[model samples]
Target: MKSLILHTATRLMIGILILFSLFLFFRGHDEPGGGFIGGLVGAGAFTLYAIAFGTDLTRKVLRVDPITLIALGLASLVVSGVIPLITADPFLTGKWLFLEWGNSDIKLSTPLLFDIGVYLCVVGFIVTVIFSLEEEN
Candidate 1:
């Protein structure tokens, strides 16, 4: 049975949850909250939706297969590791890149890439398990 209130509230909360997940992800590099927690929160958002609606609807909202997320995450991790080796740095060494756009300077780093990979993997794994469990029922 679907609760109309739950479906409506979940639709609203999903966006907020995703936004907060990103905030946590960005803050992770320098602060305490990193990819792991961010990904968990992200996965929780989907899980909540699945409960309110159904796993099939959640999958449609996801747009891509969970396995694809895992694949991309792994690839990103490998690339982050290999990038340092290309410069003769130790494996998994942090690399920094700076970009200037007009008056704004953007700092990019390998660690952030690695974190992104972690986030994707965590979200993918959790979602896959949840979907599978739902399908079994």
Candidate 2:
């Protein structure tokens, strides 16, 4: 059975969940939160949506295959490791780049890239599993 309240609440909450997940992802490299937690939260949001609706709608909403997310995420992970090798550093050594933007400096690091890859992989793997289980039901 369909639920009016659930549908309405899900429509509102999904965006909030995704935004919050990003917040965690950004703060992770420095603080307690990180890619793994962010991805779990993100996957939970979609899983909630799947439960309220169905797997078909969930797939449509995603707009891309979960496998694609996994592939890209793996590529990101590999690239993060390879970046240090190019500079003659040990594998997976943290590298930082500073970019000046309008009198402010932005710091980018390979660890963050690795974390992002983890985030994508977690989300993709969980969602794929959830979709499979939901479909089988």
Candidate 3:
């Protein structure tokens, strides 16, 4: 078992890491960061939590199995690519949808969805591998 200080520190760090990961994921479209980096950071947080607590506890905290996450991510990516085909665009062509708000416009695109899928896929794969390895030992 981890000491009280380690457990407390991990609990605090996990929240910060997850928030930062989301920041990286969202800011990726117009900036340098992207899905892969964001996913890595997020997975790292979970890994730390697993280490401080236990793999079973981490899995319980996550609620969803990593394998499910992988499947969903792959499905999302496939759907994102296929969506443009309905408009007669080539594969993976970006489709944009703009939502008008009171004072600002929110832009959504296929590429963003694709990035989200990539993020999910990476995080799921990494976590699954890590946990499986931990369980084996």
Using TM-score as the measure, the top candidate is: 3
What are the per-residue Cα lDDT tens digits for candidate 1 across 21-137? Answer: 999999987888999999999999999988898988998999989989989889889888989999899999999999999999888999889999999999999999988988898
Candidate 1 deviation (Cα RMSD): 1.2
Q: If both were scored by TM-score, which would come out higher, candidate 2 or candidate 3?
A: 3
Return whichever of 1 and 3 wins on TM-score.
Answer: 3
Greater lDDT among 2 and 3 belongs to 3
Query: Candidate 2 — which pairs collide?
Result: 28-33
lDDT of 1: 0.92
Q: What's the TM-score of every candidate structure?
A: 0.94, 0.94, 0.96
Which sections of candidate 3 miss by over 4 Å?
A: none
lDDT of candidate 3 at residue 96, scale 0 to 100: 98
lDDT of 3 by residue, 1-137 (tens): 56898899998999999999999998898998999999999999999998889899999998999999999999989999999999999999999999999999898999999999999999999999989988998
Query: How many clashes show up in model 1?
Result: 0
**How far is 22's C-alpha from truth in model 2 (Å)?**
0.3
Residues 31-79, candidate 2, lDDT per residue (tens digit)?
9899999999999899989989988998999988988889889999999
lDDT per model vs. reference = 0.92, 0.91, 0.93
